[model samples]
Target: MSYLRFDKTLLTNLEESLTREVLRTNRSGAYHCSTIVDCNTRKYHGLLVIPVPELDDENHVLLSSLDETVIQHGAEFNLGLHKYHGDNFSPRGHKYIREFECEKVPTTLYRVGGVVLKKEKVFVHHENRILIRYTLVDAHSETILRLRPYLAFRSVRQYTHENAQASRHYDEVENGIKTCMYPGYPELYMQFSKENTFHFQPDWYRGIEYPKEQERGYDFNEDLYVPGYFEFNIKKGESVTFAGGISAIDTASLNDLFTYEVEKRIPRDSFKNCLINTAHQFLNKQGEESYILAGYPWFKCRARDMFISLPGLTLAIGEVEKFEVVMQTAVKAVYAFMNGETTDLKVYEMEHPDVLMWAVWTVQQYAKMVSREAAKEKYGQLLKDIMTYLADGKHPNLQVHDNGLVYANGREKAITWMNSTVNGRPVVARTGYIVEFNSLWYNALRFVADLFVEDGEFSFRLNQIADKTAVSFIDTFLNEYGYLLDFVDGNMMDWSVRPNMIFAAAFDYSPLDAKQKKGVVDIVTKELLTPKGIRSLSPKSGGYNPNYVGPQIQRDYAYHQGTAWPWLEGFYLEAYLRIYKRSAISFVERQMISYEDQMTCHCVGSIPELFDGNPPFQGRGAVSFAMNVAEILRTLNLLAKYDNQ
Candidate 1:
């Protein structure tokens, strides 16, 4: 009863296996992603996808996939699968799979004609590298293994075509060869632990159709270059290690390096441990500081996501130093933004209003995890400067009203997390007095007041501001139906039922009264609650789109309208526990079981970004989402605190 193992029956079932994906990442912002059966159904699917500094800032696909074939007495059996044009599968290697396990790392077993081989893959953290070990678990005699490397030297957003611009060449290094198809792109070094065979036959693999890309309404066909094959001979119980990296690896040290990397991993025996391990992958360090990646395969380090995810991904794991480092990095980035020192908009830019509020909330969480003195010692002046800047309306499209509520207004309505826009217009125009932003704003103000008790004048100012905001929060947002209005501006109240109101009751320093808290919880539980998570919008709301499907524009509209985000479960659970007290522990425990079960589906040991709001909420969006994983870990940490109490 291995919790994360899939037998041959499931592996051979193309429909089932292809939908499920496995992800491995290195903190260097590189990843390995493919279907459970080693088949790539999407252009983003690759054995090595890393950020190329010299190229565009986006990720690029270097090694699309590696096809391994077993040669037994001249009969060759390909243990790799690929889908070509016309919906046809070539080599059908999935049929030979014995089992797929993902407890420690992703391991696949293959049994072919009395020869049993097990393949294990691990992405080295802090480096752009992948180590794959192939062991002949059982065999009657020596067997030869041939590996063909498929190279797609293109951005992850674009499809590659057969062109003469690609240099079909290689340079020998250590125990293997290094090559770069495109000049200025990082050179790809591939090597085996033992030198056996290398043949340089360059060819093109054309008409490779990625169905997932087509489903997303994009060009689905690609052409990858195959740079010959490498042959290896192995006897029973002998293992050979293969290394693929952007830079030339120490070929003589591959065996030791692989062992060291695998041994350094903490055991993941439980779902909690699995999530903690996955959470660690979301952290990448540059220079001497650490940053949190929003999600895998696509998303980069986002201010909003990193702040929202900080508590769970770092402090919840008892990583106080790393949490401090992240906060320091964020503060430095903010200062850089203020000083106009950075043109790197993606990292330094702060557009979302709620993201700024979450930054203060993250400091409050860190204060709880460490100490007020420690937090203030590191971030006190920085926090004060940010508060002053925000209060003076230095941030774009945002200002504090004389009534004390934060107001953000812009023609571009994509200012908050519900920032899904179609064409040039926002799909959900929640421009003024957004629910979540105000709740967090109130919370942030209150937190600063409490944290800086010594600064009486500043604390008094924040308290007065918070008190004014509280009155407006209730008067403007609370509707007659007992549910909070989603947002309000000049008698135009967007009275949509959304999970954003939950934060009012979920936070420690909530402005909502007991009756208001209960009303908010009841409304959300009744409409937005699902086994997976809380939906962004209620189904009964006008313009509610229950499914997160279709092409880019369609998907964008559904993204925040009704798509269920699993990460919001943490806030919902917090509000539920706050409203119910100790009695809610059992309920929380029961609800958490579903998430643990979720680990067995979709991306094994990881979480997906969005799910359908309708019943039977299938996982949608990114295969491995960092925010979802962080939220799950955060909930488990909170659960532990409640259970202990």
Candidate 2:
């Protein structure tokens, strides 16, 4: 569990939701620097900002509200700022960003009536069952301008360890504290409070105001990862929900919000070990299942995300209870998807074809993983029905194409993730023959095949599903040159070398031998490899573009052409693990070119959402995605165990 910031109503990354981020991506000209640092306070894993507001300097104010920001963190940022950057620059003399190792936990805020409450979770050690739930009350506000707040907190840990020092100096400092030049105009800032609250500071006090410039003792709003509390402001009689990443001092939670931190120490599963312990840190923290597919950066809820991320986020890592909760939430979506309640079905979501496929896969996978027999029976049977619906092509007015892929709002695009678009045309969603879709299909077929494998149990139906897949993979997908086509019936540029081919056999479905697998790997490795991770396509493709740092529209148009997605890094790693089951070490060497190169040289540990499509690749887009990080870590764990002599 890297780090998550959530409230009862909304959940998002704690570091991400800070109001200061608005400055980083600001259309105005405000710079932001945020980091997860030790209480001792020096910047480590420093995520600097080369703020590029979406607006072209119509207004220039960082502290005011505008959403334009340019986030450059870790190695990706280092390269972009140092080598490839244009006007975007980090401070002139500060050392470049590097990934620092610090075990942080999920942070949360909740609104309970007028009192907005908060919870901070910390896992000092993964194997340990100890989970510290630090609860506090967020300050409220009448107006952000005039507000003062107070808070109190106590740490109740039986086990103790010293926190690394992170006092920050604009340059460097011993306690991690550096007096700001005392005079400079930067968008974000930090400082220490002069007053006392209940004899000591609160366990956690966020929601500080970001000044238009740095004030000596102040740094970034998210700099401190400590368990102590700080105070801001609260409106006297105004209502508060008890959760907020930042506050203008609307309402205050007095003694009610303050309490000794409680360690809801649950027993760790002695049964299995891997990244499970870390996964549990995020997944097991109260109500994690309900929030799945809910938002991006952890936003944007979808049926596909809940199930696709179920094992890694909820099940394999967290408690069994979360599995049930997520399964419950997802099963409804599965049925809805099978019945054609796509993202477009709701007024909020425009429809798409991927939901059905993702739901079908999730329902079955959930059924398979659930330890309960009754749930297995019910969901398994439901899976069969869903699979049958997919087999027969069951949308009412919608016709399934010859190759079993669902089309967008009647003849439009939109099948898989990468469902973003520009000027009404789908961006990177290679509809007809997406690699992962067929990979997922192959998995479903094999899942059924395994279920009835005893005496060729599912042999008839299994063989049929397998045969259909084989036909589709060979006849529909395989282009004359033998390379799998990227899409079935799109524009003329369907043969662009992309990561889609890896999915054909990554699961149990493909009839892929070493030769076919070798071809797919070769195409992707040569064309897709960038310093950050896997590029979306061959740089040589006509539609390809590598510069992902810019306005959303431009980014979307060039989105998949050459953007290096860390998510694809997982699939590529998975394919390597599957194909070279024996040559694990060698495959790992090839699979992790970016991580090895970038993590140490660029963004050390934290994986950025994407890299610029071109050379001197810089991380761009959302700072991180759970699936991406979890999968990369999973890949590393795979290498660790398999490579063990």
Give me the candidate number with maximum TM-score: 1
How well is each residue in 1-645 modelled by candidate 2, as lDDT tens digits? Answer: 222222312112223222112101111111222332111111111122222123221112221111101111211111111111232222211121122221232233333223333323322221211121222343333222111111111011111122333222232121111122112223122122212121122222233222211211334232122222223233433322221111121123321221211233222222122134323322321122343532112233445544555555554343457766656655655566566555322111213445555555554544444543544465666656655665565744233455544333423565566666877877764654555656666666666555545536443665566666666666666666556777665553367877777766455456566778767776777788665678887877778887774556777766677888766766676676776776756756565554543332122223455778787786665443445555565466556667774
lDDT values of the candidates? Answer: 0.86, 0.42
Number of colliding residue pairs in each model:
0, 70
**Global CA lDDT computed for model 2:** 0.42
lDDT of 1 by residue, 1-645 (tens): 566889998889998899888888887678999989999999999999988877787889999999999988888999989999787999899999999987788899999999999999999888989999999999887699999999998999998999999998898887789999988898999998888678999999999989888888778999999989999888899889999998877677887888888887765668888788888888877657678888877888888888888888988899887777777678877777656575443453366676767888888888887788887888888778878878877877678999888888734667777778888888888878888888998998888888887899998989999999999888888889998888887888888899989999999887899888999999999999988899998889998997888788888888998889988989999899888988999888877887776676777777888899987988888877777887777888888888889
How does residue 93 of candidate 2 score in lDDT?
A: 12
How much is the lDDT of residue 277 in candidate 1?
80
RMSD of 1: 1.4
RMSD of 2: 15.3
